[model samples]
Target: MKLARRLQAIKPSATLALNARAKALAASGKDVVVLAAGEPDFDTPEFVKQAAIEALRTGFTKYTATAGMPELREAVCRKLEKDNGLKYAPEQVVVTAGGKQSLYNCFQALLDEGDEVIIFAPYWVSYPDMVHLAGGTPVIVPTREEDGYAPDPAAIKKALTPRTRAIILNSPANPTGAVYSRATLEGIADAVRGHDCFIVTDDMYEKLLYTGEPFLNLGNVAPDLVPRLLVSNGLSKSYAMTGWRLGYAAGPKALISGMQLVQDQSTSNASSITQKAALAALNGPTDTITAMVNEYRERRDLFVAGLNAIPGIRCRLPEGAFYAMADVRGLLGKTYKGKPLTDSLQLSEALLNDFLVAAVPGDPFGAPGYIRMSFVTSREVLQKGLTRLRDFVAALG
Candidate 1:
């Protein structure tokens, strides 16, 4: 059997791999607390589910346009105007399977062989892989934990080379939960104004912010870059619609047309009923989102403080998103249950095997001394998991 070299080189998603292991353990009657998955633990709001049911009952199962149903596109445009203060026409948007596909569409439409995309670490695990799949090189700029994992504009400028085609931005980021400041976003936008590179902003967590700080959309901040800026978002995170598999992007009409063509050949369109559900999500009441964010904020505070209380674990206070990436270097050289703990991956596996707690290693996200713990579960589960983690690390002494 033969396979493409590009496909051969790509690695499976680390998050999903860890999740499968956790599921295996759970199947064996082990009480596993999984902190590796990225989706919110909340259920889809009732109204959205009802909308999907109604759509199916009303025979909305037929295929719409390749781009999307016009009504949904209009709803998405209205959402942009209502939330981000940006204006877009239906032609500028392309609906896809999920936020992941929206990103893939951008890569497929814009990237050529040897093109370089600048990504900040610790980034979402999928960015670099997607770039590789599209035959582009991913140039990673390492950002420090002390800097909230926000990329330095100067560093981005230094990473630029003749082959650079775009820069990827993920705010309220995965793994680290680092939200870029408005000033930093403006600086990056300004730095790339004259350059010939596109700016792809993943704002999937835009509505998941817990901090009082304002989220400045790059397109809104620098309308001059609208032609080159691509904003990707979806109902998965903010609206607890992960299983619905619906995402959309807004950009220039030409680039969006390219994405539409790619979708036409690949996915064709998102699930028709899911599209109707997403329409209700976008245009319906947003109170569920606000309530979810508030609950996550409380969990974040509780979990971060609890993790820090554990000796040898130091977790930074995350401003947005639901993850707390704790630096575990203090426990690296110690022994846990008579086994030597060496790196983040080893520590994560040990926690899962010994403490029945599953977390994601930091190495996959460009850091090697930390582990990401998600607080998407209930408060009781978070407390119990923290206790188990604390006891396990304390045993190292």
Candidate 2:
């Protein structure tokens, strides 16, 4: 059976695949220490869950507007205004299945065939594939690990071309938790000044910041870019509502309408009950998120320290999010058992199969010499994973 040609250009999410493999091994009683998760281990706040329960009791199970529940869209607006210092009307917002969908809709709405989207290295795995699926090419600009994986403004300018349609920025980024600072954002704003490309900001991990500084996106530092910025965020990471399938984006009314149209023909409204729960999440107290961030900070310090202590691994203390992108380049050229540890993929496989530890390789993230480990699990689990990783490195010859 012939499949869509688009499938040829993409692969399944590396993190999800590793996570599933780990779960399967655990199901088989292998005692696999799964550390590839992108979601928080914390359960959804009870108040948010109660909101969904109430919605079910009140028979709010029907389909909502193709865009989303009007109230929920309004709540999204409130979130943007209060949190991001960016104001938007409900007409300028569209809620989709997840932040991923919100971004997919943006690309589908904005990109023409042969268009290009600038993405930084150590980026979210889905960005390039999503761009490919939308008939847009992904222009990867590699960031230095020493720079905290922050995108360089001059490098971005050098990558832009007549075909460049948009630039995607994920602050408190995935895989690598590099939060773009206000200065960094302003530099990017300066670099893209003459360009006609839109800036897509995925703020999925905005609430998971470990930095002592405040969260800032390109929109916040450069209000002029707000018109062209598509701010995508969701309840998944911040509110621990991964299964809720509710995410939203706000931009120009026309772009929002175009994204809404794209969504209308696809998975229409994000789940109806999830919309209610999202409403509660957006308007509810953020104490739960604060608690989660605090716990993640402790785990981050511990796990990163553990990785750095290993003979050949060096890990940076991430500024935000829950991942540690460890440079295993020093460990390369060695053999695990008899197999050569050639790259991150091979290293990841060796760790998972031989050491019963699962971590996402950085090769899929455009960083071949590194591996990404999530500190999203409990401290005990993190310690166990670290122990296994140490033993794996020690066994490599």
Candidate 3:
């Protein structure tokens, strides 16, 4: 049996692949320090869990609406209005299996064959492939580490074309954790003023910011873009509800309807109980998130400092999220067990196989010679992983 040709252009999620490999190694009695996962180490808040329990006890297991339950959609609207300063009706909201699915739905609803979606380099590993799977071309624009991995408006403008249908922006971005500045966002808004493409902002890490400044997406800086903007968020990263599989998006009613139709024929409504739990999370206290953010700040400082202290590794301080993208170019071209370590993939393999440390290489993220490590684990685990990484680099001849 022959597979579809599209499968040839897509690769498995690099982060999840590394995580599974690390778990396999650990199950085999290897002491692997895994940092490939993007989820926080914290559990879902007790109140949220209790809400799910209540739903289960009441036998609320039947499907509701394809978009979401009205109450939850209204809760999501309230969340956007309160936190993001974006007002929307419940009609504009669509809750899906996860933020990933929300994005996938967006691409499927918006893209036709040969349509283009602009993505920044060092982006989340799933972005490019998701676009490809939707029959769209992913136009990657490289962002320099020196620029804090922030997308450049001028470069983005230059990349825009007649076929460009959308631009995906992930601030407090994954892998790099670089938050876009207000001026940068404004500039991007200005650049796209006359363009017909939509803007997709993934604010999954909005609450994990360490910077004192307020979180601002393209919508906050440019209200005009709201008409064409799709804001995707979830309870996974910020609420520590990775297993809940509840995410939502707010956009124009037409796009929401399109996404709902796509979802309606697909998974239908998300898990009924999970939606109740997500409603609780949306309306619940954010104190747990505050505590988690405070702890992650400490871990980020420790991990970045530790990475910098290692020879041939330099990591910029991430302003948000829980990842550190370390530049490992200095360690490349060195001999590892008499074979030349040429790229991030080779180096990552050496770290995992020989040193029992797991990290996602940057090649799959469109940034070679780098590796992304999550600091969501405890400081003890982070320290151990850093030490092993240091030893691995030193062992390179």
Error of 1 at 22 (Å): 0.9
Report how far residue 56 has shifted in candidate 1, in Å. Answer: 1.1
TM-score of 3: 0.99
- Cα lDDT of model 3 by residue, 109-136, tens digit: 9999999999999899899999999899
Per-residue CA lDDT of model 1 for 1-397, tens digit only, reads 7889899768899989998999999999999998888989999999999999999999999988988899999998998888888899999999988999999999999899999999998988999999999999999999998777777888888999889999999888888888888777788887788789999999999988877866778887788988888889999999999999999999889889999988989989899999999999998998998899999999999999999899899999887878899999999989877767889999998899889999999999888899998999999999999989978877785
Better of 1 and 3 by lDDT: 3
The collision pairs in model 1 are none
Task: Judge candidate 1 at residue 346 and give its lDDT.
Answer: 95
Q: What lDDT tens digits, residue by residue, belong to model 2 across residues 293-363?
A: 99999999999999999999999888998889999999999987887878999988888888999888999
TM-score of each: 0.98, 0.98, 0.99
- Tell me each candidate's RMSD, in Å, in order: 1.1, 0.9, 0.8
